[model samples]
Target chain A: MKAIAVEPGAGDPVVVEKPVPEPAAGEALVRTLRVGVDGTDHEVIRGAHGELPAGSDRLVLGHEAVGVVEDPNGTDLERGEVVAPTVRRPPNGTNEYFERGEPDMAPEGAYLERGIVGAHGFMAEYFTSPAETLVPVPPELAELGFLVEPISITEKALEHAQAARSTVHWEPESAIVLGNGSLGLVTLAMFEEVLDIERTYCLGKRDRPDPSIDLIDDLGGTYIDSRETSVPEIPDAHEPMDLVYEATGYAKHPFDTVEALAPNGVGALVGVPDDWSFEIDGGRLHRELVLHNKALVGTVNSNRGHFEAAVDTLASIPGWVTDDLVTGVYGLDEFERAFERNESVIKTAVEFDTR
Target chain B: MKAIAVEPGAGDPVVVEKPVPEPAAGEALVRTLRVGVDGTDHEVIRGAHGELPAGSDRLVLGHEAVGVVEDPNGTDLERGEVVAPTVRRPPNGTNEYFERGEPDMAPEGAYLERGIVGAHGFMAEYFTSPAETLVPVPPELAELGFLVEPISITEKALEHAQAARSTVHWEPESAIVLGNGSLGLVTLAMFEEVLDIERTYCLGKRDRPDPSIDLIDDLGGTYIDSRETSVPEIPDAHEPMDLVYEATGYAKHPFDTVEALAPNGVGALVGVPDDWSFEIDGGRLHRELVLHNKALVGTVNSNRGHFEAAVDTLASIPGWVTDDLVTGVYGLDEFERAFERNESVIKTAVEFDTR
Candidate 1:
C-alpha cells in the first residue's frame, strides 16, 4: 500500500510503502477513491499543527476522504458501496460525549482526529474504520464525495447559529460570507440551496474574473473585493447583514463582522485566526453587541448528524457547482501538485485506484 | 416642582424648579418616591456621556426610579399604586422593534433612554409616562422598587445567555459575578433566587466588611477580593466557571473571563467597558470559543417583559437584602449627598414625600 507520511515536527512529507490494513469485527476495510486537499492538510504538512500516531514517527495526512467499501466484516455496509469516512474517532475508554454519540462535542484532547491527531488518515490505499463511522454516499458522485467533510463543517455551524437564534423569531433575509475560498463558496451554495435567504454576498481579497467570484455570481450572490472595500463599510454600502459567515482565518474579520451585523444578528465563525494582537474599539464593539442583541458563535468539526445532513445538501445542490469548484484532480505520483496555491483553484483532490 | 438637572457637557448638577407635569390620555402622572443611583447616573453627571432633553439646557438625571401613580388618566394604573418606570422609550415614529414590544433591540439612535439620552427622566417631584411603560411594584415594597430597573438589566442578560445555550442540555452548577457593584449584587441575588446554581463567587476590588461583599456572603456565595488576584487566575484559584456574569465595566475583564470559562460555559456580559484598547491572544480566545462550545452574549436595557420578570425577582428576594443594599435615603433637599461615592454605601436613593 502507498501512503503519504509527515514527520511530527519536521515539515517534510513523502510517499512511502506501507502494509495493507485488515478490518476487525464490526469494522470495514475501505479502499480510497479520492481525498480532498484542504488548508488543514497544508498546516499538518508544514508542521504548524497536528499530532503523530502513537509509537510512530510519522502521521498519515488526509481527513477529508471518500472510499469504496472493499470488505464489510459483519457490518450492514455492502461491498463496493461508496462511503465518506468520518475524520475523528473516540479515544479508547468511555467518555460521556462518545457514549452519547457526540464525539465532536468531546473536550480538548478527548477524541483523536484520524490523520490529524493520534491515528492514521485515509490518504492510504487501504484503511480500516468502525462501520458506524462510515457515511454512505451516492456511487455516481464518488469524486465529489470528498467535499462532504468540509460542507459538514458549515452544516454544524449553521445548526448552532439556528439554535442560538431560535429564542427570537429571526428569519434571515440577507447573508454575507467573509471569505471566497471553497468552504465559503460551498457555504454560499448551501445558503442558496438549503436556507431561505434572499440576498447574498461573498467578500474576498481577490479581484474579479476569479473562479470563486464567478461561482458566487452564478449562485445569484454578489462578490465584494476586500482589497478595494473594507468590511465595516459593507453594511452602509449595501444593507446591514442579518447573518455573517466568517471563514477568512483573519484575526480581525470576525470582530469587523460583529460590527457589520444588523439588529438581532448572528456571526458564525469557522476561521481560526493567526496569533496576532490588534487594537479593537472595545467600547464600540461592546455597545453593538449589547444594545443590538447580537450573538457570535464559533464551530469547528462536525458530528455524524451534520455529515448526514451534508450528504443531503450536496445531493440537492446543482452538480455543476461541485464540478466547477473541484478544479483539479491528481494521481498518487502527482499528489504534491494538489497543495500548490492557484488563484483559479477552488478545490483539488488526489484520486486513488484499488485494482 | 423640583428636579435634579445636569448641564449636558458640564459636570455640575443642581436641584432646579420645574412645572409640574400633567398626565395626557393613556398616561399616568407619577409622584416619584425614590430614585436609586447607579454608575450610569454618575457617568451622566460627570459629562462623560448623556444627552440633554430637547429645547432644554439641563437633563434630569435618574433612570432607576420608583413612584406612585397620582393620576391614572383613564389607564389601567391605579392611584397610589407603586410602579417602576422604564427608562427607554420609542422614537417619534413607529419603529418595528417598538411596535413589536422590543424597544431594547431598537437600532442605535432609534430609541431615547430616559435620563441617559435625549428624554427627561423621573427624578422630579412629578412626571408623566405612558401607562404601558410603568410596571407595577407591590405597594409594600415602595423604596425597594427603585432596584427593579437595575435588576431588569440582569434579567435581560440572563435571558440572552439562556437563549444562546438552548441548543445543548446545559445545567450550570457554579457561577461567578465579575464586579461587586450594585448591578453585581443584584445579579448575585438573582442567581440564587432564580437559577438552581449552587456554588457562587463575586469578584471585586473592595476590602472585606463592605456591604456589597457582606450581601454576597450572606447569600451563601464567596467573595473574592480582586486586588489580590488577577482575572485570569480566578478559575485556577477556585474552579472553572460555568456562568460568568460580567459587570465590572473594565475593558479587559471580559476577554480574560473568556479564558476562565469551563467547557460548554456561557458568559453573559452586561458591562459596558471604557474606551480602552488592550492586547489579547486572539488565537487562543478563538480556540476556546470554538472547542469548548462557549458563548458570550451582551445585553443592555430591558424590555417590558423583563421589567415584569424583575418585579417578580425583586419580590421573591428577602426584604433584608434590599434593606442592607439601599443604605442611603436622602430627602429632596439632601439629594446632592446621594451622588457622592462613599466606601460604606452600597446603594443610595433620593426619597420624596408622595403621601
Candidate 2:
C-alpha cells in the first residue's frame, strides 16, 4: 500500500510503502479515495506543530480524508459504504470529554489526531478505524466528501460565535473574514448563503486578478487589502463589524478584532499562531472589550455533530464554487504537486483511487 | 442643598451648596441617602477618566446611590419610595441599545453614566432623574440598598460569563476572584451564597489580620496572596479554575486569566484599566484559548434587570456580611473620610441625609 508520511523536523512529505492495515474487532477497514492538504499539514512538516506517534520516527500525513469501507468487520457500517473518518481519538481509550461525545473539547495530551499528532493519519491506500469514528457520507458526493472535515472546523467556530450571543436578541448584519485562504472563502460563502449576512468582507494582501478575491466578489463579498487597511482600522474604513471571523492566525488579529467589533459583537478565533512576543496596548484592548460588551471565543477542531452539519453546508454550496476551490488533485505517482505552494492555488488534494 | 463636586484635573471633591432641583415632567426628585465611592470615582478625580457635564466645570461624584423619592412629578414612581438609580442614560435623546432596554451594551459616547461621566451624580442632597431610571427597593433594605449598584455590576458580569456556556452543559464547581477589594469580596460572597460555587478563592497581597482576608475566610474561601502566587500560577498553586472573575484592573491579569482557566472554562472581566502598554506571549495565550475551548467576556454597567436581580442577591446575603463591608458612612461635613484609601477600609459611603 502507498501512503504519505512526514519526518518531524525534516523536509516535505514523501511517498512511502507500508503494509495494508487490518480491521480489529468493532473496527472498519477503509480504502482511501481522497485526502486534503491544509495549513496544519504545512506546520507539521516544518516542525512548528504536532507530535510524532509514540516510538515512530515518521508520522502519516492526512486527516481530511474520505474513503469506502472495504471491510465493516461486523460493525454497523456496510461494505463499500462511503464514509469520512473523524480526526480526534481518545489517547488513553477514555476521558470525560470523549465520554461526553465532545472529543474536540479535550485538552492537550488527552486526545490524538490521526495524521496530526501522536497517531498515524489516513493518507494511505488502506487504514483501519473504530466503526463509530466513521461518519457516513452520501455516495453521490464522494468527489467533494473530503471537504467535510475542513468545513466542520468552520461549523464549530460559528457555533461558538453564535452561542456567545444566545442571551441577547442578536441579529448580526455584517461580518468580516480575516484571511483569504480556502477556509476563509468557504466561511465567507457560508456567511452569505447560510447566515444571510447583509454585508460581507474578506481581508487579504493579494493583488487584483487573484482567484481567491474573485471568488469573494462572485459571492457578493467585498475584499479589503490588508496592506491598505488593517483589521483594527476596518470600522473607520468600512463599517463596524457585527461578527469577525479570524482565520489568519496572525498574533495581532485577535486584539484587532476586539477593536473592529461593534457593540455586543463577537469574534470567533480559529487560527493557531506560533510563539511571537510583541508590545500591545493591554489597557486599551481591555477597555474596548469591557466597555463595548464585546466577546471573543477561541475554537479549534470539530466533533461529529459539526461534521454532520458540514455535510449539509457542503451540499448547499454551488458546485462551481467548490470547483474553483479545488485547483489540483494529484495522483500517488505525482504527489509532489499537491504539496506545491503557488499564488494561483486555492486548494489541493492527493487522490488514492476513484472507485 | 449640599453636594460633593470635583473640578476635573484639579483636586479632591469639596462641599458645595446649590439650590434644590425641580423635577421635569417625567422626572422624580430624589433625596439622596447613601452614595458609595468606588475606583471609578478615584479615576474621575485624577482626570484620568470620565467627562464633565456639557458646559459645566465641575462634575458631581456619586453613581452607587440609594435614595428616597421626594417628588414623583406625574411619573410611575411614588413619593417617599426607597429606590436605587441606574447609572447609564442615552447620551443622545435615544439609541438602539437604549430602545432595546440594554443601555449597558451601548458603546462609548453613545451613553453617559450619571455621576461617573457626562451627568450629575447622586452625591447631592437633592437630585433629579427620570422616573424610569429608578428601581424600587424594599424599605427594610434602605441601610444596605446602596450596595445594589456595585452588586449589579457583578450580576451583569456573571450573567455574561454564564451565557458563554449556554451551548454546553457547564457545571462550574470551583471559582476564583482576582481581587480582594470591596467588589471582589462582594462577588466572592455571591459566588458562595448565590451561585453555590464550591472551592472558592480570592487573590490579594495583604498581610495577616487583614479585614478583606478575614471576610474571605469567613465565607469559606481560600486566600491567595498574589505576591506569593501570581495569576497564571494559580492552577499549579491552587487548582485550575472553572470560572475566573477579574476585578483588579491590572493589565496583566486578563492574559493571566486565560492561562489560569481549566479546559472549557470561561472568564468574566469587569475592571476598567487605564491606557498601558505591555509585552506578552501572544501566541501561547491564543493557542491556550483555542485548544482548551476557553472564552473571555468583558462586562461593564448593568441594566435595570440586573439591578432587580441584585436586590434579591443583597437580601439573601447575611446582614453581618454587609455590615462588615461598609467600613464608614461619613456625613457631608466628614465626606473626606469616605474618599480616603487605607489598609483597613473595605467599603465607604457619604450620607447626605438620614431622613
Candidate 3:
C-alpha cells in the first residue's frame, strides 16, 4: 500500500510504501477513495502540530477522507459501502466523554485525532477504523464524500448556536460568514439551504470578483472585502447581524463581530486563530454580552451525529455549489500539487487508485 | 413624600421631600414598603455610574422595591395588591427589545433603568410604574419581595446558561458560586433549590465560620475561602465545576472560571467588573472554549418574567435562609446606616412607613 507520510518534525510529506492494514475485531478495513487537502494537512507537513503513532517516526496525513469498506470484520457495515471515517478517537483509556459517544468534546490532550495528532490517518491506500466511527455515505455522494468532515464542523457550530439562543424566540433575519475560505463558503451555502435567514453576507480579504465572492453572490448573498471594510462598520452599513459565523483565523473577527451583533444575537466561531495579542475593550464587551444577551461559541471538530447531518447537508446543497467547490482533483501521485493552495481553488482532493 | 436621593457627584445619599407621583393611563401608583440596597446603590451614590431623571438634580436611589399598588388607573392591577416593581423601563422611544417584552436584553443606551439610569425609582414613599412592568407578588412573600429583583438577576443568568448548554444532555453534578455576596449567596441558594447538583461550593474572601459561610452550610453547600484557593486550582481541589456562577466584580474570575470548567460546562457571569487590564493567555482560553465545548454567558438585568420566576424562587427558599439573609432594615431617617458595608452584613434594606 502507498501512503503519504510525514516524519515528525520534518518539513515535508513523502510517499512511502506500507503494508495494508488488517481489520481487527469490531474494526473495518477501508480502502481510501479520496482525501481532502486542507490547512490542517499543511500544518502537519510543516511540523507545526500533530504527532506520530507511538514508536513510529512517520505519521500519515489526512483527516478528511472518503473510503470504501473493503473488509467489515465483526461489524454491521457492508463491504464496498462508501463511508467517511471520523478523525478523532478516544484516548488510550476510557473517559466519560468517549463512553457517552462525545469524543469531540473530549478534554484537551484526552483524545487523539488521526493524522492531526497521535494516530495514523487515511491518506493511504488502506486504513482501519472502528465500525461505529465510520459514517456511511450514500453511493451518490461517494465522489463528494471528502467534504462531509468539513461540513460537519458547521453542523456542530449551528447546532450549538441554535442551542445557545434557545432561551428566546431567535428568528434571525440576517447572518454573515467572516471568512471566504471553503469552510466559510460552505457555511454560507448551508445557511441558504437550511436556515431561514433572509439576508446573508460573506467577508473576505481577497480583491473583487474571486470565486468565493462570486459563489456567495450566486448563492444570493453579499460579499464584503474585509481589507476594504472594517467588521464593526458592517452592521451599520446593513442591519445588525443576528448571527455571525466566524471562520477566519484572524482572532479579532470574533471580537469585532460581537460588537456588530443584534440584541440576543449569537456568534458561532469555528476558526482557531494564531496566538496574537490585541487590546480589547473588555468592559464594553462584557456589557454587550450581559445587557444584550449576546453569546459567542467556539467549536472545532465534529461528532458522528454531525457527520450524518453533514451527509444530508451535502446532498441538499445545490449541485452547482458542490460542483464549483471541488475545483481540482489530482491523482495520488500528484499529492504535492494537490496540497498547493490557490485563489481559484475552493477544494482540492487527492484521489486514490486503490483496487 | 420622602425619597432617598443622591446628587450626581455626591458620595452620600440623603432623604428629601418630593411630590407624590400620580398614576397616568396604563400606570400604577405604588406605595413603597421596602427597598433592598445592593452595590449598585453605592455605585450610583459615588457618581461612578447612573444618571438623574430628566431635569432633576438628584437621582432617586432604589431599584429593588416591594410595594403595594395604591392606584391602578387604566390597568388590570388592583389597589392594595402586593407587587415587586421591575427596575428597567422602556426608553422614551420604542425598540424591538422592549416592544417584544425583553427589556433586559435591550442594547446599550436603548433602555433606561429606574434609579440606576434615567428614571426615578421606587425609593420614594410612592412611585409610578407602567402596570405591565409591575410583577404581582403573593401576600405571603410581601416582606421578602425586595429580594425578587436580585434573585431575578440570577434567574436570567441561569436561564441563559441553561440555554447555552442545551445542545447536550447537561445534567450538571457539581457547581461553584464565585462570590459570597448577596447575589452569590442567592445563586448558591437557587442551584440548591432548582438544579439537581450533587455538590455545591461557594467561594468568598472571608474567614471561616462567618455568616455567609454558615449560611452556605445551612443551605447544604460548602464555602471556600478564595484568598487561600485560586480559581484554576478548584478542579484539582474538588472536581472541574460543571457550572460556575460568577458574581464577584473581580475582572479575572470569569477567565479563571473558564479554565476551571469541565468539558461541556457553562459559566454564568452576573457581575460587571470595573475597568482593569490583565494579561490573559488568549490562545489557551480559546483552545479551552473550543475543545471542551464550554460556554460563558454574561447576564445583567432581568425582565418581568424573570421577576415572576424570582418571586417563586424566593418563596421556595428555606425560611431561615431568607430570614437571615436580610440582616438589617433601617427606617428612612437612618438610610445612611443601611448603606454601610461590613463583614457581618449579608443584605440590608430601607423600610418605609407606608401605612
Candidate 4:
C-alpha cells in the first residue's frame, strides 16, 4: 500500500509503500472505496497539527474515507454496506474521555496509530478499524463515498455551533463564512438547516464565477469581498454575533470572528490552523470579548453522536446545495494529483473497487 | 452641609459646604452616619473616573454609607434604622440596573452620577435617595455600618464565580484571591460563606500587616506577599486553578491568576481599571484556557436578587469577624484622619451623632 508521510515541521511529504494492517481482536477489516481530502489532511501533511500521533513521520494520512466491511462486521455494520468511517475512535480501547464526556479528545485520535500520524491509512486498498467505529452506510451513498466524510465534518461543526450558543433552535441574526472553500460552503449549508438566520454572508476571494458563489447566493448568503470592505458594513459589526464558525485553517479566523461578534455571540473554532501558537490580550478578552457574555470554543473532530447527526443532516440536504461544492472523485492511484490540486477541488473522494 | 468634591479629568478633592437636599415623592432624606471611603470615592473625588456626570463639581462624594431615615418619622426605613443606600434609582438613574425577569446590566454605575460624578454623594451630613434603595442593616450586624456596599460587590463576584464555573458547590479543590484590600478580604469572606475551599491563598501586601491579611489568616487562608515574592513560588503556578477571583483593579492580577487555574478552572473578574483597553487571543484562550472547558467572566454590579443574596451572607458572619477584621471606629469629624491613614484602620466606620 502507498501512503503519504510528512517529516516534522514545514517539510515536503514523501510517498512510501507500507504493509497493510490486519484486524486485531475487537477490530474489523474494510475494503476502501474512496478517501476524502480536507484541510486537516493538508495540516497533518505540513506538520502544523499538534494532535498528530507521536512518530508522525511514519503516519498514513487521510481520515475522511468510505468503505465496505471485508471481515467480521459489528452489529451496526454489515458487509457491502457503504458508510463514512467515524474519525473519533478510542485508541486505548477504553474511555479516555470519560471525564469530559467527549470522544474526540481521546489521546489516540483516529488519524494516529492507524494511518493519520503513526498508523497506516486508507489511501490504500484495505483498512482495519475498531468494529465499534465501522458504522454502516446506506446503499444510496455509493457514488457519494468520500463526500460523506466532508458532510460528517459539517455535522460535527453544526453540533458544536449548537452546543456553544443555545439550544439548536436559536438562529443567529446573520451568519458569516470567512472562506469560500467546500467546507465553508458546507458549513453554511448546515447552518441554514438548523438556524433560521435572516441572512448568510460568504467572505473570501471570488476569483472566478464559480458554482460555490452561486451556491452561496442560492443559500441566501450574500458574498463579501473581504479585501475591499471594512467592518461595520453589516448592521451590528462590532456587537455580539449569535454564531460564527471558523472552517479556514487560517490563524486570523478566530480573531476576525471575535471582533465581529456581538455581545453574548458565540465563536466556534472548527478549523485546525497551521500555526500552533495563538496570542491575544487577555484583558480585552476578559472585558470586551464578552460584551453581554459570549463564548469561544474549539470543536475538534466529532464524536460518534455528532457523526450520526451529521448523517441525518446529510440525508436531508437543505434546499441550498445543488451538488456544487463536491467536484472530483478519484481512485487510490491519484493520491499525488489529490494533493497537487487540493485547493481547486471542492471535495475530492477516493473510490475503491473490491473484487 | 460639608461635602467632598473634585474637578474634572483627574483633579484634587476638597471638603466644601453644599446645600441640603429636599426629599420628593418616593424619595427619603438620609442623615449619613459613617461614609465609607474606598477606591471608588477616591477615584471619583480625584476626577479620575469616566462615568462622572457633567457639571459634577458640585457633587457630594460617597456611595458606601450607613445612615438613618429622617423624612417620614416612620418612613419605609425607621428613623433610627442603620442602612446602606442603593445608589442606583430607576427611569433616569445612573445605575441602570432593574429586574425584568432578572436584573439586566448595571445602569451607568452609582459613582458616575451628579453627586458622585455629576450627582452629589453621601460623604456629608445629609443625603437624598429613593425610599426603595435602603437595604435594612439587620440587627445582628453589631458594627461596621458602612461595609454593606463593598460586601455586596464581593457577594456579586462570588455569585458570578458560581454561575460561570461547572460546579454549583463553592468547595472545589481550592480557591485563590488575587488581592487583599477591603474588596479582596470581603471576597474571601463571601467565598468562605459558600464552600470550605481546601486552601484559599490571599496574595497582597499590608502597610502594617494589612487588616485583610489577618482576616484571611483567621479564616484559614494562606497570605502571600506578592510585592516581595513572585507568584511562581507556588507549585504548579502554570497549572489552571480551581477558582480564581481577581479583585484587583489591575490586568496583571487576572493574567497571573489565569495561569494558576487547574483544568476547567474559572477566573471571575470584578475589578475595573482606569487606563488602557483590553484584548484577548480568541484562539489561544479556547485552546489553553480552562482545561475542562474553563471560563472567565466579568460581573458589573449587584442586581436586585444579588442585593438580597448579599444581605443574607452579611447576616451570618461569625464571632471571628469582630475580633479580627473590624479594628476601630471613627467620628464623622475625624474623616480626614480616617482617609489619610486608612490602612492602619483594618476596617473603620464613622460615629455620626457624636454629640
Candidate 5:
C-alpha cells in the first residue's frame, strides 16, 4: 500500500509504499476512499500540533476520510462496506469529546499518519481501523461521504444554536456568519433549510486570489468580504447579530459579534482557532452577555445524532453536495496534491481507486 | 418621605427628605418593611453598576427590599399586603428578553428614589412601585423576606447549572466553593439543601472571617483556607469537584482547582472580579475545560424558576435569619451606620420607623 508519511519533528509528509494492514481482533481494515484535509492535518504535519508520540517516526495525518471495511471485523462492521469512523485507534480515537452517543467527545482522533500518525491513515491506498469506528455511508452519500467530519461539526454547532428547532415556521431571525469557508457555508446551508433565517452574512476572505464566493452564494448565502466591510459597523440589524458562527481556522477569533450579540442572542464557536491565547472578560461576558442573557458556547463534534441529522440534511442539499464544494478529487497517491489544493484552492477531495 | 441617596459616582449615600411618591396608573404605593444592602449597592455608589439613563445623578442604590402595599393605586394589588418583587420598574415595563422570561434585561430596575437603584429603591421610608412588580410572600415568609434578593441570585446560578440537566439527583460528587462571603455560604447552603453535594469545600478569607463558617457548619460544609493548605494538590481518593461556585468576583482569573475538574464537570461563576481586562489560551480552556465536556457558566439574578426554588429554600431556613446571619438593625436616617454595618455584618435589617 502507498501512504502519506511524515518524519518526526517536522517536514513535508512523503507519500510512500507500505504494506497493507490486517485486522486485529477488534480492528477493521479499511480500503481508503475520500480523505478530507483540514487545519488539524496541516498542524500535525508541521509539528505545530504536537502530534506524534515519543517513539513514532513518519506519522499519518488524516482523520476525515470515508472508506470501506476490508476485514471481516469483529463488532458492528462487515467487509467491503462504506464507513466513516472518527478515530484512528481503539481507545483514543477521535478527539476527547467524540463519544458515540456524545460523538462530540470522540477521543483518539486520526491525524498522525497516512502511514504514520500512530497508525496508518486513509491518505494512503488502505488503512486499518477498529470495527466499531466506522460510520456506514450509502451510495447516495458517495460524493459527500468524506464531508461527514466537517459537516458533523456544523451539525454539532447548530445543536448549540438550536438552529434546527426554529419555530417561526421557516423564518429564523437574521443570521450573520463570519468566515465563508466550507464550515461557514455548511452552517449557512443549515439555517437556509432547517430554519427560516431571512438573511445570512458570510464574512471571509472574499478577495482571496481564488475566491470561494460561488460556494456561499450557491448555498443561498450572502457573502461579505470581511476585508472590505467593517464587520462591527454593519448597522444594528446586522450589528447585533441573531447568531454568529466563527469558522476562520487561523484563530478566527470573535472580536466583532461577541459584544454585539442581541440582548438574548447566541454565538456558537465551530472553528478551532489555532495557536492563540487571549483573554475573555468573563465579567463583561457576564455583564454584557449574561446580563442580556447572551451566551458564548464552544461545540466540537456531533454525536451519532449529528451524523444522522447531517445524513438527512445531505439528502436534501442542493445538488446534494455533488454540484459544488467538492472542488477536486484525486486518488490516494495524490495525498500531497490534495493538501496542496486545500491550501492553493479550497475544499479538495481524495478519492480511492477502490476498483 | 426620606431616601438614602448617592450622588453620582460617590462612595456613600446620605438620607434626604423627599416627597411621598404619587402612584401613577398601573402603579402602587408600597411602604417598605425593610431594605437589604449588598455588593450591588457598592457597585451603584461607586458607579460601577446602575440601570440609569446616560448622565444621570441623584440615584438611589438599593434594590433588594420588602414592603407592604399601602394602596393599590390602579392595578393588581390590595391594601396592607406584604410583598417582594424581583426588582424591576421598566420604562414601559417591558424589554426584549424579559417579556420573553428574562428579567436581567429590564430597562428601569428598582434602584431609584426608594434609595437604591434605577427606579426609586427601598432604602427610603416609602417606595413607589408597580403592582405587578410584587411577588407574593406567603405571610410566613415576612421575617426573612428581605433576604429574597440575594437568594434570587443563588437561585439563578443553580438554574443556569441545571440547564446541563445531568446532575439533578444528588450524585456522589463533591464541591469546592471559592470565597466564604454571603454568596459563598449561600451557595454552600444551596448545595446542602438543593444540590445535595457530598462534600463541600468553602474556601473563605484565610480565617472564618464572618458568620459564613457558622452558616456552612449549620449547612454541614467543609471549610478550607487557601492560605493554610496547598489547594493545588489533593489526595486522589479525595473526590474532585463536580461543581465550583466562584463568588469572590475574580474576572478572567483561573481557579487553582480549574485543572482538577473531572470529565464532565462544571464551574459556576457569580463573582465579579474587578479587573476589566485579561487573557487566556482558548485552546487550554478547550482542552482543559471544554474538550472534556467541562462547562464554565456565568449566572446572575436567576431565572424565575430558581427564584421560586430559592424562596422555598430561604423559607425552610431553620431560624428566621434573626439569630445568625442577620447581625444588626438600623434606621434609614442612620444611613452611614447601616452602610458601615453592611460591610462588617453578615446581614443587616433597615428599620423604617426612625427615618
Candidate 6:
C-alpha cells in the first residue's frame, strides 16, 4: 500500500510503501478514495502541531478521509458502501466521552485523533477502523464525501454557538466569518443556505482578484478586506454582527470578536492559535461580555452527528461553488501539489482511487 | 423625602432632602422599606461607575429595593402590594430589548439601570416607577425581598450557563463560586438548596474568623482561600470544576476559569472588572476552550423572569442562612455603616421603614 507519511520534527510529507493490514472483528477495511488536506495537515507536516503514533518514526497524515468499504469484516456495513471515518478515538480503552458518542468533548489525555495526534490516519491506500467510527455516505455524493470532515467542524461550532444563545429569543440576522479560508467559505455557504441568515460578511487580507473573496461574493456575502477594516472596527465600518464565526487562528480575533458583537451576540471560535502573549483591554472585553449578554463558545473536532449534518450541508451547497472551492485534486504520485499554498488555492485533496 | 446621593467624580454619598415624587400615568408610587447595598453601590458612591440622570447634579444610590406600592396611579398594581422594581429602563423610548422584556440584553446606549447607570434609584424614603417595571412579591417574602436583586443576577448567569450546555448531556456534579461576597454566598446557598449540586466550593481571600467563610461551611461548600490556591491551580490542588460561578471582578479570573474547567465544563461570569491591562498566554487559553468543550458566559443585571425566579430561590433558602448572611441592618441615620467592608460583614442593608 502507498501512504502519505510525515516525520515529526522533520520537514514535508513523503510518499512511502507499507503493507496492507487485515481488519479485526468489528472493524471494516476501507479502500481510500479521497483524503482532504487542510491547515492541520500543513501544520503536522511542518512539525508545528500534531503528534506521531507512539514508537513510530512517522505518522500517516490525513484526518479528512472518505472511502469505500473493501471488506465489512462481519460488521453491518456493506462491502461497497461509501463512508467517512471520525478522527478522535479513545486513547487507553473507552472513556466517558466515547461512551456518550461524543469523542469531540473528550479531555486531552483521554483521546487521540488519527492523522493529527497519537494514531495513524487514513492517508494510506487502505486502512481499518472500528465499524462504529464509520459514518455512511450516500453513493451519489461519494465524489465529494471528503468534504464531510471540514463541514463537520463548522457544524459542531455553529451547534454550540446556537446553544449559547438558546435561553434568549435570538434570531441572528447578521453574521461575519473572520477568515476567507476554505473552511470559512464553506461556513459562509452554510450560514446562507442552512441558517438563512439575512446579512453575511467575510473578512480577508487579500486584495482584488482573490478566488476565496470571489466565492464569498458568489455566496452573496460582503467581503471586508482585513487590512482596511479590522474585526473590532467592523461595527463602525459596517454594522455590529449578531454572530461572529472566528476561523482565523490569529490570537487577537477572539478579543476583537467580543467588541464586534451586537447585544446578545455570540462568537464561535474554532481556530487553534499558537502560544502568543499580548496586551489587551481586559476590562472592556470583560465588561462588554457581561453587560451586553454576549457569549463566546470555543469548539474543535466533530462527532458522528456533526458528520451526518455535514453530508446534508455538502449536498445543499452549489456544485459550482464546491468546484471552485476545491481548486486542486492530485493523484497519489502528485500529492505534493495538494499541499501547495498559492494565492488562488482554496481547498486541495489527494485521491488514492476513484469512488 | 430623604435620599442617598453621590455627585459624579466626588468623594462619597451624602444624605439630602428631596421632594416626594408623584406617580405619572401608568406609574406606581412606592414607599421604600429596605434597600440592599452592593459593590455597584460603592462604585457609584466613589464615582467609579454609573451616570447621573440628565441635567441632574447628583445620582440616588440603590437598585436592590423592597417596597410597598403607596399609589397604583390607574395601573393594575394594587396599593399596599409588596414589589421589587427591575433595574433597567429604556434610555430614550422603548428599544427591542425593553419591548421584549429583556432590558438586560439592551446595548450600552439603549437602556440605563436605575441607581446603577443613568437613572435615579430606590434608596430614597419614597420612589416612583413605571408600573410595568415592578414585579409583585408575596408579602411573606417581603422581609427578604431585597435579596431578590442580587439573587436575580446569579439566576440569569446560571440560566445562560445551562443554556450553553443544553446541546450536550452535561450533568455538572462539582461547582465553584469564585467569590465569597454577599452575591457569592447567596449563589452558594442557591447551589446547595436550589441546584442541589453534589460538591460545591467557594473561593475567597478571607483569613480565619471570617463570617463569609463560616457561611460557606454552613452551606456544606468547601472554601478555597484565593491566596493559597489560585483559580488556575484549583483543578490540580482540588479538582477540575464542572461549573465556575465568578463574582470577583478581578481581570485575570476569566482566563483562569477557562483553565480550571473540566471537560465540557462551563463558567458563568457576573462580576464587572475595572479597566486593567495584563499579559497572559492567549494561545493556551484559546486552546483550552476549544479542545475541552468548555464555555464561559458573562451576565449582568436581570429581568422580570429572573426576579420571579429569584424570589423563589430566596424563599427556598434556609431562614437561618439568610439571617447570618445579612450581618448588618442600618437605620437611615447610620446608613454609612451599611457600606463599610469588614471581616465579619457578609451583607448589609439600609432600612427606611420596616415591613
For each candidate, what TM-score against the reference? Answer: 0.92, 0.95, 0.92, 0.76, 0.81, 0.95
Residue lDDT tens for model 3, B55-128: 98888889999999989986999999999988888777678878888888777788899999998878889999
Model 3: CA > 4 A from native: A72-74, A92-94, A220-222, A230-240, A274-278, A353-355, B72-74, B207-210, B217-226, B236-239
TM-score, candidate number 5: 0.81
Q: Residue pairs in steric clash, candidate 2?
A: A115-A121
Mind giving the per-residue lDDT tens digits that candidate 3 earns over A249-285? 6767666866888878888877775666656666666
Give the per-residue lDDT of model 5 (tens digit) for A1-355. 7777676456787777778877778778887777877666777776765455447576766667888777756767877787776643323445433333454543224223332245545677677765555677786675577788677777767665543112111123767777766667666777776665777777776454444676666667677766666555654435466677767643424434556555445566665554467766645554454344444555555555566666677666667444466667776555567767343365776676556
lDDT of 5 by residue, B6-122 (tens): 875755787777888888887788787777777777777777766553364677556777778888886778887777766644454455545555555332241122333446577
Off by over 4 Å in 2: none
Q: What is the lDDT of residue B72 in candidate 3?
A: 91
Which portions of model 6 miss their true places by more than 4 Å? none
Q: Between prediction 2 and prediction 4, which has the larger lDDT?
A: 2
DockQ of each: 0.51, 0.74, 0.50, 0.15, 0.27, 0.75
DockQ-based class of model 6: medium
lDDT of 2 by residue, A54-161 (tens): 999999999999999999999999999999999999997689888887888888989999998899999999999999889889998788888999999999999988
Q: Per-residue CA lDDT of candidate 6, range A1-355, in tens?
A: 9999999668888999999979988999999999999999988888888887889999999999999999999999999999999999999879988999989988788889999889999999999999999999999888788999999999999999999998888999999999999899999999988899999999999988889988998999999998999899999999999999989888878888889999889999999898888888888788888878888899989999999999889889888889889999999888999999989899999999964
Per-candidate total of colliding backbone pairs: 0, 1, 0, 47, 56, 0
lDDT of 4 by residue, B1-355 (tens): 7766556445555677878788877778877777666666666655656345554434556777777776643356667666677654443533323433123343233233324445566777788776666777764552555777777766655665554432212246677777877777777776675556667777776644656776888888778777765553443543335777777766545445445665445666777654344443434444543123444555555544555566676676565774566565666555555555455555555455442
Per-residue lDDT of candidate 2, residues B85-137 (tens digit): 99999897999988888888887888999887899888999899888889988
Model 4 lDDT, residue A342, Cα:
37
- Candidate 3 similarity to native, TM-score: 0.92
Please provide, for model 6 over B55-117, each residue's C-alpha lDDT reduced to its tens digit, 9 standing for 90 to 100.
899999999999999999899999999999899999887888899888888778888889978
Q: Evaluate residue A247 in candidate 6 and report its C-alpha lDDT on the 0 to 100 scale.
A: 94
lDDT of 6 at A190: 91
